[model samples]
Target: MKLEPHYLKYLAETQDKDYILLDLMANYGNDVWNFAYFLTRSSDAADDLSQDVFLSVYDRIYSFRGECTMKSWILTITRNKSLNYLKKQLIRKILPVKTVPHGGTVQSAESQLFDRMETKRIWSAVIQLPRKFREVVILDAHYGLTDKEIAELLNISQGTVKSRLHRARTKITVILETDNEGE
Candidate 1:
């Protein structure tokens, strides 16, 4: 999900805590949960982490100075929560999961099945990346966050983000090539 351009302004102008939070949740809930799932690879953990993220947002609303977009703020919270959950659980394993790209046009059954398999294969390679690399790739490719945004969210320099993204793409290419050779 993409960030609405006026969301930060809307959030700032709103005075009622409940209304602001509900609006945030309505706008960003799926994005938050999906990011959590990408990090943890567990639906259950994503559910818990998303809840905690919203709770933190509610508690820390006053702290938001609008330095960043509202989506960035919410996603930063989600990333921190997911990482903390991973650390606490000692879970570094990433299970492969299919995330089919969204498309509208209908396709033949054979074409659809092939697309699903290809998407799954690509996602499988992605999840196999190290946490640092995987997070950058997902943030860039899936969430469409720019290098500066990702650096801010991940607490790394823009150069580091670029390096990681480059390395991650190289690794993914090698992996897919290997898979094709094996097949």
Candidate 2:
């Protein structure tokens, strides 16, 4: 997407202003939400996280140095927010292992059923991976982010991203193939 000069000027010069920040959020909101959804595996959680990311972006817009595109910056925020949310969920699950309720009661019954059938089989396999590997898989396969972009967002080396992604794909592939054999 070509950045309009006026937009660039506004971002570069007046990004601290609320209206400019709101404009940026409006333009990139859907993209951020999609990225968050791909990471979270829940549309409702993605919606909440996307809103949080945009709020963070709005507050931090003036800190942008144009080192990367606005999309990348926004995606970085989305990734961080999603990761934080995942960590919180994991902690909650771990802490309440005995107390947490487990049953077949789902608020979105229709959507849950559809999700079970239509969900990417590979993603279910991917989730079985350790967190680091799962992250690489989600960023690469699910979100279509390049290794360089993933590295930039995750603040890691490109080689690390490549290795993790390779390992993740192999693990997920094995899981899927094994499941297929059992079925």
Candidate 3:
């Protein structure tokens, strides 16, 4: 019988303990946080969701069968947690709110202006997409996951992923064009 790699053997050996799991969480913390932030668009919510995702990963790590990279597996968990958080917020009518303080000077006003404009353009287009299409766009564009990876993560067919991505791109383009027409 051939032996597995040292890391996999180590992982399998220590997979049951909380500290080892904490190490995994620490290693992947930033990746998970960034993914959540991209999905939620709120720093506070993203932070909380990242923690929830790590908890879920810790609980479910034993179920990992090495079919996908650990990072992909963790991302799948993060995506699910983010969507669940969004759904709960909608149910509670606690949608994310951004507040600007009065009389506060923003450093680099010109850059801030550019950022605001770009964000408006991008989010306006994205917001027009239906949930299924928007999710694929977010996961692919923001998180840089391949279509096959997304299909596995989403448990959907590759054709479905491609279709949704195509629809999302067309919707975004239409929204941008309409905005340009108004301008």
lDDT of each prediction vs. the true structure?
0.88, 0.71, 0.73
Which pairs clash in the backbone of model 1? none
Q: By descending lDDT, how would the candidates be arranged?
A: 1, 3, 2
Encode model 2's per-residue lDDT on 108-172: one tens digit a residue: 97876555553546555765677678777767764567778788888999999999988887888
Output the TM-score of candidate 1: 0.90
* Best model per lDDT: 1
lDDT of 1 by residue, 1-183 (tens): 344546556666777778888988998999999889989999899999999999999999878777777888999999998988988998877776956577879999999888899888988899899999999999999888889999999999999999999999999999999999999
TM-score of each: 0.90, 0.69, 0.70
Residues 1-183 of candidate 3 have per-residue lDDT tens digits of 112244356567774557757767777798788677656666888899888887787677667677776777888888888888878785322233232222446759897776667666776577556668877887787667788888999999999999999988988988898888999
Off by over 4 Å in 2: 1-7, 13-23, 91-119
Worst 10 residues of 1 by lDDT: 1-10
| Candidate of highest TM-score | 1
